[model samples]
Target: MSFSDAIKICFQKYMDFNGRAKRPEFWWFALFCVVVSLVLGMASSALSTLFSLATLLPSLAVGARRLHDTNRSGWLQLLWIIPLIGWIIMIVFLAQQGSSEDNQYGSTPAN
Candidate 1:
């Protein structure tokens, strides 16, 4: 997916994490998130400390949507609670192919 498409998906789903996401869709959005955070973080760190908090909500929302695209419950994302293992698991899921033709959430990303 294109960067614009990924960002659109991020906001469209917002908090939904029960579908499947293709690789481009996930990574592009992720890149956007990181770039945004870095810029905002630098601004906050140098200017108002409080602005650093900006990344929190956006990050969660994007993460939840990314999980949804994976066909996994957003709740499963909490698996990141386990630290390294959780992180590894989440990465694996993101790396896996989306449902071939939609398992239950909606339609296949390929379609």
Candidate 2:
């Protein structure tokens, strides 16, 4: 998907974790989130508290979709409970490429 489309979908689904996402879609949205967070952090120091709290949902949504992209369940996030191993596994999973075509989750991301 295009960068703009990814950002749009990220917010459109904001909290959805059911569908699959491709690498471009996931990473671009991630970049959007990071940049937005930094900008918001600088622009509204007083509001940082609220923005920080609010960012959690979309961040989770992106992470969940990133998991789905790798053909893993979003529930894998719970693995974070297992000390360092879980975080490593999550990083590796996020780094891996999505299936080239469709898998059980859904169709390939829009071209």
Candidate 3:
């Protein structure tokens, strides 16, 4: 998915954690968030903080959905607490392609 479409879908489903999110959607939105955060931080700390707070939930929701797409539980995100290795593992999980066949999560998201 394109960056704008990913961001739009993320915000539209801001609090939703039940569906699946494709790799492109999740990664594009992630890049958007990082770029926005960096730009806002360069402009003003307060603006950056506000943006981070505002996007937190949507980020988590999309992340959870992304995990679901990999056939993993959203709760697995807690592994990030484990430091470097944990972060690497989470990245690997999130970067993986979704299962071709449906598992416990919903059907594959349409491209």
lDDT per prediction? 0.66, 0.79, 0.94
Clashing pairs in 1: 17-68, 18-68, 19-68, 19-71, 20-69, 21-69
Candidate 1 vs candidate 2: which has greater TM-score?
Answer: 2
Which run of 10 residues does model 3 get worst, by summed lDDT?
A: 100-109
Which scores better on lDDT, 2 or 3? 3
Estimate, for each residue in 5-95, the C-alpha lDDT of model 3 and write its tens digit: 9999999999999989999989998998999999999999999999999999999999999999999999999988999999999999999
User: Is candidate 1 or 3 superior in lDDT?
Assistant: 3
Candidate 1 ranges with C-alpha deviation above 4 Å? 15-19, 46-65
Task: Give model 1 RMSD, 1 decimal.
Answer: 3.2
Best by TM-score: 3
Please write out the lDDT profile of model 2 over residues 54-89, one tens digit for every residue: 767876887788788788888888887889998898
lDDT for each residue of candidate 1 in 23-62, tens digit (9 for 90 to 100): 7777787787767767766667553334335434544665
Per-residue error for 23 in candidate 3, Å, reads: 0.3
Q: Supply the TM-score for candidate 3.
A: 0.97
Off by over 4 Å in 2: 43-45, 80-84
lDDT-based ranking: 3, 2, 1
The numbered model that scores best in lDDT is 3
RMSD of every candidate to native, in Å, equals: 3.2, 2.3, 0.7
In angstroms, how far off is 110's CA in candidate 3? 0.5
